[model samples]
Every structure is written in structure tokens, then in C-alpha cells.
Target chain A: MKIAVLSGKGGTGKTLLSVNMAVIGENTTYIDCDVEEPNGHLFLKPKEVIKEKVAVKIPVVDMGLCNGCQKCVEFCKFNALAYINNKLMVFDNICHSCGGCVLVCPEKALTEKDKIIGEVQKGVSQGINVLSGILNIGEASGIPIIDKLLGEEPKNSQKTIIDCPPGSACIVMESIKDADYCVLIAEPTVFGVHNLSMVYELVKLFNKPHSVILNKCLDGKNPAEEFCIENNIKILDKIPFDSELGTLNSNALIAARESPKYKKMFSEIFKKIIEEAQHEAAVNP
Target chain B: MKIAIPVNDKSLENGVCQSFGRAPYFLIHDIESKENTFLNNSAALSRGGAGVKAAQMIADNEVDALLTPRCGDNAAGILKVAKIKLYKTEGDSIEDNIKAFNEGKLSPLMDIHPGLHDHGGR
Candidate 1:
């Protein structure tokens, strides 16, 4: 089963939970979908097995074309093209590669050229296959790289864990679209609960089975417990607000590895997820 | 000529909108005629960091000038290519700033502050 770990806000222990889960569930394929700031590899320490450049098609105007009509500029929906002194200027950054300008250019001055926006890394860590995409600095779009990473999916059926980016936006949706189950990691805070509801709504819209992993659960009464109970969402696990875990995470170390105490916790969480997925399959079958 | 003033909101008293930061609408108004048209910047409001897109809108609309509180270097460079004059908003009032702009009270702000270099002022 493919499982996607998502959160609406950053720093809610999404990556930590995902990496530990992958380690516990050996032979699993872990995909780090946080292309903007992918930090999964920092903790997982996957050896560089494969690296591929991700490219996007951008329009390149040929000045040699006889006529310099502003039609190409006018037809560009992204405003990537402009006419200066009867010459067409193509802005690579703004181009969405829709080919609308090329279609409208009667003189055939516009042509598409590939531009490298980012790269995807595929590697193995502790027997778990890890794939992550890193968008180049100053690059505006991360969706393209995420798409390229998704395209690297193996044909064989195996348990896959996708560490999705923050927010329930298009990029996150794209990454988690085909997942069999989704695990939303949230903190027990006002902001966390608020954004959790947003992600919950998105998962519901997709009609995917989901559960919550409450990271940094306060020692006192947990507010999210009541909300989760009301919504009929199961609390898979509660990672306590431990300062040791925080320190280990900051030091680029997985908590489960540094402290044997947390291994059982992550193992239990993984077991519960598998059981839940099994139950779902049984009910559907 | 109708000039587009990027604003923080639809209301006239609201602060001028910066291309690099969070803001709502781009108030397009005529300098000589004093007529106003507020084009809701849906892209900027929803997607974040749509300064380049907004500048393209200004160019497509054939705006005379873009009055903003602050702008990033990339957006400023794009506007310059479209031949859109970039003017810094001096006062808070929309009318007052437009009047100041028309009367040549405001000068072209060269060397934008380094803080306004990127989206979210990073």
C-alpha cells in the first residue's frame, strides 16, 4: 500500500515520522515530495545511487525569423514574451511552456528549448529505497521536479511512503494523489489543529482513508484527542514532547537510531498503519 | 493616462502594495482624469509572489506608471523591460500619492532597498 505522510504547516515532525516509519518498514520505497526544502535525505543519509536532471520546456525565440510581429507576445498567457523595438524577448523564468505563443506566431519565430530546473536523487538507506527531488535555488516552480520524481516510480507493487510537503496545495495533492492511505502529522497546537482541519478536508475530498499522528503531544490533556474522536479519525500514535528527540533531530540523527526507546514506538506505529490498511482492503474486497 | 497603483487593499486610505510582499489589489487609476479602477490581484492574493505576473498585467493594460511602496529587483527589472515607470509611493493616501506623482513630487526610486529583494521580503 502506498502511504503519504502530510502536514499543513512546517516543523510538525512530518519528515521525522516518515523516515522512522520507512526504517521500521524495511523494503519500503520512501519518496520525499518536499521539493522546495527536502530534508529527508539529511536524516536518512541515503547514498547517491542515481541522479537525473529535471528539465522543463521553455520557449526560445529565434531572431533570424523574418518578421517581428508582436503576435507572439500578445498570445503568451504567462507574459513570458515581450516585444521590444519590433523584436520578441523571451523570459525563461516566466514561461510556463504552454506553446500558446508558438502556436500563434505566424512567422514561426518561437521554439521550445529544454531548461534544467532541478534534479532527482534516487538512493538506498538502511535497505529502504529513498527518492528525493531538489529544486535549484531561485527556481520558482517545484511541481515540475515533483512530477519528475513521481515518474521514477518502480513497476513492482511494494509498500511506498511519500513524505509530502506542507500545505494542502496542488503540489501536495499531486504527490499524494495515488496513495492508498494518508497519514497526517500534526502538533497539538491551535495553528496545528487549524491547518489539520484543512488537510483533513482535502483528504476527505480525495476520499482517501486517513489517520492522524500527533507529534509533540502535550503532557497535559490533548485538545486534538477530542477533535479526532468527534471526527472518527484514529490517533495512530502520539510522539511525546521530548527534548531529546528535538536535539537528535536538529543534529541530523533519527531519534529511533539514537535512542532504542523510540524504535518500538515507530515500529508500533508502522504495525498499526499496516493493520489499518489491511482492514481497509478487507472491507473493500 | 491611466496608471496602475499596486495597493494593499481596495480602500483608498490603505497602504501602497509592494510587489515582493503580501498585498491584495492593484489600484489602476487615471492620472489626469482621476478615474479609478481597482483590478483585484487574484494571483498575488492566492498564489503568493506574483509580482512578475502583476507587472505583466500592468504592461498588458498599457499602464502609464506602477506606484508601489516597495518592489524587488527582479520585478523592477521586468517592469523596466515593459517600459513601465516605477515610482515609490510617498504618502499613505491613494489620492495624495497620485497627486504627488502627477505633480512630479515623487522621484524615480533608484537602488531599491536590499530587504525588498525577494518574495516575502527574504
Candidate 2:
């Protein structure tokens, strides 16, 4: 079964939950889908076995054989082309490399070129295989890198745990789209509940079964729990606010190793996810 | 003969320079023709980073010059490659800024702020 852990806001322990869950699953493959700022390797400490450069198609304009009729500029839907003094200007960033500009160019001045935007790293940590894609620091769009990472998924694996980036943006949706089930990690604060609702809506749009995991559940009362109850969503588990867990997390230490108290907690969460996936399968069958 | 000034509405009006939440409007004006095109910055305003996307817009738009208070290093390098001139805007008003640019009154920015990443080699 493939399980994805996602949150709407950053610093909500999405990586923490993902890493711990992978550790507890034993023999699971961990796919870090957060291509922008992949922090999973810091915790997993994987031995990178292979690294591949990821490239995007950009436009390359030749000035020599050009009529510069501005047809390429007119054909570009992204506004990635311009004509100046009978010269064709190609904007590499805005060029979606759709080849529309090239096709419409009267002089055949436009051609496609490869621009390195990011890299994909495949490694192994303990018993689990790890794969992560890192977007080059200045690259704005991460969807292409995410697509490359998903394409590199190992063919044979007992269970795959996907670590999705924060928010309900296109990148996050793409990462969690094919998951058997999704684990929405949220805190009990108002902000957490609000973002959780946003992610829940995204999951609902995909028609995927999802459950909430309230990390750092507030003492005495849980606002997320109430929200979940009102919305008729099941609360998977509640991990109490633990100071030591927070400290270890900051220092890039695995929670299951640093705090023995949380090993059973993660194991319990893993078992529940498996049970839920099975239940989903049974219902569908 | 037109210069493009990429700025958020707040920076164009208040003169309060902020690192984030800049508007996505280009103040384009022809120096000789006196024609103006306030083109909306379709890419940079919507996207977060001020790197490849910004550079591409300037290059592809055939913008002769850029007028802004500051720029990240990656953006500067990309613009340099695209042969777009970078200048720092002095006045607060969009009209005054364009006038200054047309009269060759604005100063070229000497220092490029090191963005989250430096593209020195490329």
C-alpha cells in the first residue's frame, strides 16, 4: 500500500511524521516528494547510490537564418517570445517548450534546448530504499522535478511511504494523487485545522480515502478532534505534545531512535494505516 | 526605445521596499514615442522566486532596460546573459521614474544581492 503524509503549512512535522512512519514500517520504500526543500535525507541519512540531472525544455532562437516576422512571439501562449528590431528574443524561463513557437516561426529560428532545473537522487537507508528530487535553488517551478521523481519509483516494494510537501498546491496534489490512502498530519491549533480543511478538500476532489493524524495534540481539549467529528472524519491517532520529540526533530534525529516512547506510537500508526488500506480494498472489492 | 520597470504597486506608491509581496506590474514607457504600456507581470508576480522567470520575461519582452530597487544575484546573471540592462530606480512615482530613465538619470546597480543561490559559474 502507498501512504502519503501531507500538511497545509510548513513546520507542521510532515517530514517528522514521514520519517518515523518509514522507520516503523521496516522494508518500506520512502519517496520524498518535497522537491523544493527535501529534508528527508537529513533524517534518513541515505547512502546515495545514484544521482541523475533533471532538465526542462526551453527555447533556443537562432538569429542568423531569421526573417523575424514575429510569428513565434504570437504563437507562444506563455508570452515567452518577443521581436525587437527584427531580432527574435527567446525567454528561457517562460518558455514552456511546447514547440508551438517553433512550429509557427516563419524563419524556423526557434529550436528547443535542454536546461538543467533539478536533480534526482536515489539512495538506501537502513533497510529502506530512498528517492528524493532536489530543485536547483533558483528554479521556481517544482512540478517537473516531482514528475521525474515519481517516474523513478522502484517497481518492487512491499509498501511505499510518500513524504509530500506542505500545502494543497499543484505539487502537493500531484505527489499524493496516486496514494492508496493519505495521512493528513495536523496540530490542534486553529491554523492547523484551517489548513487541514483545505487539504481535506483536495483529497475529496481526488476521491481518495483519508484520515487525520493530530501531531502535538493539545492537552485537555483537542480542537482538531472536534472539527473532525463535525466533519465526520476519523482521527487516526493523537501524538501528545512532547518536548523531547521536538528537540530530537530539530537536531535531525529519528524519533523512534531518540525517544523509545514513540516507537510503539509509530508502529500503532503504521498498523492502523495498513488496516485502513485493507478495509478500503475490501469495500471496493 | 521603451524601458520596463518591474515593481509591485506598493513599492511604486509607498516607496517602502519590501523583500516580498511586490506587485506584478511592469511600467513600460517609450522614451521617444511617449507611449506607455503598463504590462502586468504575469510570471514573477505569480511565482515566488526572482530568478530564471524574471530574467526570461525581460529577455523575451525585448525590454531594453530594467528599473528596480534591488535584484537577486541569479536574476542579475540571467539578465546579463540575455543582454538586458539593469538600473536602480531613484524616484517614487512611476511617471517620475520613467522620466528619469528616459533622461538617463537613473544609476546602474553595482552590487547584485546573493540570492538563496549564486549562479556565478554559469
Candidate 3:
């Protein structure tokens, strides 16, 4: 079973819950799809790391081989190409790697070349396989890296935990495309409620079975929890606003690994996730 | 002899559009002829790289210079390659900026924004 954990807003304890669940869940592989700024490796601290570069095809114009038709420039929907000073100027950062420009060029001036956008790191941490996608700075998008990270997973092997990037963009959609169950992490602020609704709508649109994990729970009225209740979304668990966990997390320590209480709590959550996923599959499939 | 200014509307009475890439219309004015033509900015609704597309449109129109409040780096690069000079507008008035350009009163737009990518997402 594959479970994707995501949140609309950043710094909402997505890493905390996912990292802990991966540690406590047996036969699990943790894959971090937050290629822009993946921090799961800092907590996992995997050993014997293996790195693989991920690249995408971008158009390279051969000035000598062509006539100035302006076809490639007009063909690009992203406007990644332009005709300037009687030469075709290709913006590598703006290209979406659709390869339409290359195909549209009748003069054969455009050719594709591999541009390294990011890499995937695979390693083992405490018997759990940890994988992370890291995108190079100044890159347009991280979807390609996320694709590579999730595509390389061993088929039908064991429990896979996907730590998705923040928000309901294309990158997040790509991360949760193959997930059996989705866990939406949310906070207690009004801003948190707004963001939670965004992801909730996204999951519903994708038709993925999902539940909410309310993080940083306080004694007062919790907006995030209220949202889940109003929407009839099940609450998987609630991680309280505690300083012990905060200090450990700030010091780059996994709470589940350092504290037995956290380990026990996460184990129960993992069990609930497994049961929910199984129930969903039996009913839907 | 020909210059361009991003405008909110086709009329010269309207103020200049704050955003060059997403502007609704561009007023191309020929200094020697004193004739003005407002070309609709088709790149206004582009999903991404609107500035680049807009710059390409300006270049294709054969404008010698551009009078605007600001421009993005990608658009600036295209204009630089097209040999189109960028002049910073003095105020929101499109007609005034055009006059300022003819009188050599406008300064070069030195600072180019990094572009607001995914503004509503965060």
C-alpha cells in the first residue's frame, strides 16, 4: 500500500508525521517528493547513499543547420522560444520539455539535449529504504524530479510512504497520483484552515480516499479540526503542540526515534492508515 | 523612430498599465509620423513567460524603444537583443510619458524585477 502525506501550507508538520510513520511502519520505504527543499534525509540520515541524476530534454537550436522560419518560436505554447536578431533564442528555464518545438521545426534547426534538473538519492536508514528528490536551484519546476523519484520505486514490494510537497500545484498532484490513501496535515490557524480546504478539494477532485491529521493541537477551538468535522473527513490522529517534539525536530532528531511515546503514537496511526487503506481498496476495487 | 508603451486601454487618455507583461494593450507610436496604433497584447493571458512573449511581440513590431514603468529580466533580454531601448515612465499618464520620451526626459529602466512566478500559490 502507498500512502501520500501532504499539506497545503509549509511548516505544518508534514515532515514530522511522515518521517515518524516511516520509522515505525514495518517494511516501509520513505520517498520524499518535496524536491525543492527535501529535509527528510536530514532526519533519516540514511547510510551508504546512492545518487542518480535526473534530466529532462530541452531544445537546442543549431544555428548553422537552419533557415529562420520562426516556426519553433510560434509553436511553443510556453513561449520558451523567440526570434531575435534573426536568430532563434531558446530559454532553457522556461521550456516545459514537451519537445513540440523540435518536432515543429521543418528546417530541423531544433534538437533536444539532456539538461540535468535534479537528482534522486537512495539509502537505508534503520532497515527502512529512504529515497529523496532534490531539484537544482533556479529550476522552473520539480515535477520531473518527483516523477523520477516515484517511478523508481520497487513494484509491489512493501509499504511506501510519499512525503509530498506543499500546496495543490501540479507538483503535488504528480506526487499523489499513485497513492492509495492521502493524509492531509493541517494546523490550528485561520490561514491553516484556508490551506486545508484547498488540499481537501484537490483530494476530492483526484477521488483519493483521505483523512486529516491535525497538528499542533491546542485547548481552544481548533479551526482545522472543525473543518474536518464539518466536511465529514475522518481524523486519523492529533499531534499536540508540545515543546519536547519541537526541540528534537529543531535539533534534527526524529521524535519517534528519540521518544517511545512518539513511537507508540505513530505506530497506532500507521496501523489505522493500513486498515483504512485496506478497507478503501476492498470497497472501491 | 517608433516606440511602444504598455497601456490599460487603446485610447491615449488612459494610464499606462503597471505590469508590462499582463497589459491589456500596447500603444505603438511613431515619433516621426506622429501616428499611434494600439496593438492588443495577446500575451496578457499566457500561462507562463508572459513577459517574454510580450517582448517578442514588441520586437516583431519593429519598435525602436519602449517606454514603461518597468520590465522583467527575460523581457529585457529580448528587447536588448532586438536593439530596443527601455525608458522608465515618469507617471501613470501614457501620453505624458510619450512626450517625455520625445523630449529626452525619461531615464533608462535600470531595475528589472525577477518576475512574480506563482503569486497566488503561497
Candidate 4:
């Protein structure tokens, strides 16, 4: 079963929950799709076994093929090409690697060159395999790195958990697209509720069956519970704000609060996710 | 020599458009012919990088100078590369700015403001 953990707003503990699940779950492949900043390794402390660079194809102008039709400039949908003073300039950082520019050049002056944007790191820790993508700074797109991580032929595990980037933009959507189910982490505040609904709308748009997990909760009624009740979404679990857990959280360690309590908690949550996926599979099949 | 000015309307009697990228119309004035031809600023409707597209459009027109209140850094870089001189309006009226341009009374523009484009998603 493939599961994606995503949140609309940052600092809501998406990584925390993802790493915790990775520790407690067995035969799991943990893929951190948060290429912009993947911190899951901090918690899982996976021993690096494989490392590989990922690149995207960006257009390179030959400057010699001898025609200046400006067709390549017009064909670039991302506006990565600039023609100034009879010279072709490329701001390749923004290039989406569509290859349309090369195809449109009448004189075949434009060619594609591989540019390293990011890299995918693979490791193993505590029986769980970890794969994370690291994006180069100042780069506009991390989707290429995430794409490679997802598309790579991998050691198939019984369960796959994707740690998605924050926000409901293309990055988050692309990360969560292939998941069998999504676990949305939400806090319980006015802003949290607003962002929750926003990400919930995204999940609904993707038609992904999902459950909400409340993070850093106090004891009583909260907006997340209320919204879930009204929306008929299930509350898989809640992790109360404990000072000890906060210490562990800061150290990038998961579910060390009372060992057994948190371990049992994550195990149960992982089981619930599988059960939902199974139910959905039965219904669709 | 030619000069490009962002105008609110196609007519030379109109006022200058406050926006550079989203300007409604542009007047390309030929210094020798003393003729003014108007081109619709299609960059106004660009989904992204309107300033850069507008700069490209201006460069394509083969104008020697650009007259506007402001230009974004990205567009200004393009204009600079194309060797297009940047200038500011002496007054709001297109007629007055043209007169100022002829007398060289308009000041050169250096700094630019943020371009108007919706950040599609955060």
C-alpha cells in the first residue's frame, strides 16, 4: 500500500509523523518527496547505501548553426529563453525541460544538455528502506528530483510511505498523486482549520480516500475534530503536545515519549491505514 | 531613432499607463518620420513573467528608448541587454511626456517596482 502524508501549512509535523510511521512499520519504503528540504533522514538516521545525482534536460543554444528565427524563444512556454542584441540568453534555472525549444529551432541551433538539479539518496535503517531527494538551492523546480525518486526501480516493500512537501501546490500534488491513500496532518487553530480545508479540497480533487491526524493537541474539543465531524472524515489518531516528546522532536527522534505508548500508537495508525486501503481496494475492485 | 512609451490608449492624446508590463497600449514614435504607431501590449495578459515578455516585445519593435514610470529588474536587465535607454515621464499626459522626451527633460529611470502577476500557488 502506498500512503502519502501531506499538510497544507508548514510546521504542522508532517515529517514527524512520517518518520515515526517509518520506524514502527515493517517492510516499509520511506520516500521523502519533500525535495526542497528532506529531513526524514535526521530521524530515521538511515545508513547511506546508495547515492545518485538527478538531472533535467535544459536547452543549449549552439550559437553557430546560423539562423536567428526566434522560433525557439517563442516556443519556450516557461519564458526561459531571451534574445537580446543578436544573442540568445537562457535563464536555465526556470527551464521546465519541455524540449519544445529545441524542436522548434528551424536551423537546429538548440540542443538539450543535462543539468544536475538534485539527487536521490537511498539508505536503510531499522529494517525500513529510506529514499529522499535533495534539491539544489536557487532552483525553481524540485518536481524532477521527486519524479526520479518515485519512478526509480526500487526494492518493493509491503508498504510505501511518502513524506510530501508542505502546501497544496504542484509539488505537493505531484508527490501525493500516486499514493493509494493520504494522511493529512493538521493542527487545531483558526489558521490550521483554514489550511486544513484547503488541503482537504486538494485531496478531494485527487479523489484520494484520506484520514486526518491531529498534531500537537491539547485535551478538549478543537476545530479539526469539529471539521472532521461535519465532513464525515475519520480522525485516525491524535498526538498530544508533551514536553518530553518536544525534546525528542527537536532531536529528530520519533515516538520516544513513553516508548510503548508512542510505539503502540504509530503501529495502530499504520494498521488503520492498511485497513482503509484494503477497504478501498475491495470497494473499487 | 525610435522611442516606445506605455500609454493608456492608442491615441497620442491619452495619458501614460502607470504600469509598464500591464500597459494597455504602447506608442512607437519614429524620430525621423515623426510618426506614432500604436501596438496593443499583449504582455498585459501574460500568466507569468509579464515584465520579461514586455521587454522582449519592446526589443522586437527595434525601439531605441523606453519611457515609463517604472520597470521590474528582470525587464530592465533585458532592456539593458538590448541597449534600450530607459526614461521616465515628465508629466502624466502622453503629449507632455513626448514633449519632455523631445527636449530631453525626462529623467532616466533606474530602480523598478514589483511586476503585477498573481502568485498562482504558495
List the per-model TM-score of the A chain.
0.90, 0.92, 0.97, 0.94
Docking category of candidate 1: incorrect
> Model 1 chain A — which ten-residue stretch has the worst lDDT?
A78-87
Better candidate by lDDT, 2 or 3: 3
The model with the greater TM-score, 1 or 3, is 3
Clashes of 4: 0
State the lDDT at B22 in candidate 2.
41
User: Clashes in model 2: which pairs?
Assistant: B8-B23
DockQ of 1: 0.22
By TM-score, who's the top model here? 3
**Reference A-B contact fraction recovered by candidate 1:** 0.05
Name the candidate, 3 or 4, with the larger TM-score value. 3
Model 1 lDDT tens row, B1-122: 87777787777887676553335677888767777888876447433235555655677778878777777655666678878888778866778888898788987767664332123343
CA lDDT of every candidate: 0.78, 0.76, 0.91, 0.84
Native contacts conserved, per model: 0.05, 0.00, 0.58, 0.32
User: Once superposed on the true structure, which residue ranges of model 2 sit more than 4 Å away at CA?
Assistant: A75-78, A94-99, A103-107, A258-260, B1-89, B93-122
The digit string of per-residue lDDT tens for model 4 on A1-285 reads 788999888889888888888777778889999988889888888895698999899888888883777887777766677788888877665577888998888888888889998899999987889999999875668888988988862656878889999999889888988889899999988788888898999999999988999988998879887888999988988878778777878877777333887788778877887898789878975
Candidate 1 lDDT, A144-247, residue by residue in tens: 98888887876562788899999998888888888888999888887888888889999999988889989898777776666788899889888889888889
Consecutive 10-residue window with the lowest summed lDDT within model 4 chain B: B113-122
lDDT string for model 2 (A117-140, tens) is 889999999888899989876554
* TM-score list, all predictions: 0.82, 0.77, 0.95, 0.83
Candidate 1, A279: how far from true, in Å? 2.1
Residue range A1-285, candidate 3, lDDT tens digits: 899999999999989989998998877899999998999999999999999999999999899976888888788888888888888888877788999988988988888999999899999999888999998876778999999998888675489999999999999999999999999999999999999999999999999999998999999999999998898999988889999989999998998999899889888888988899999999998
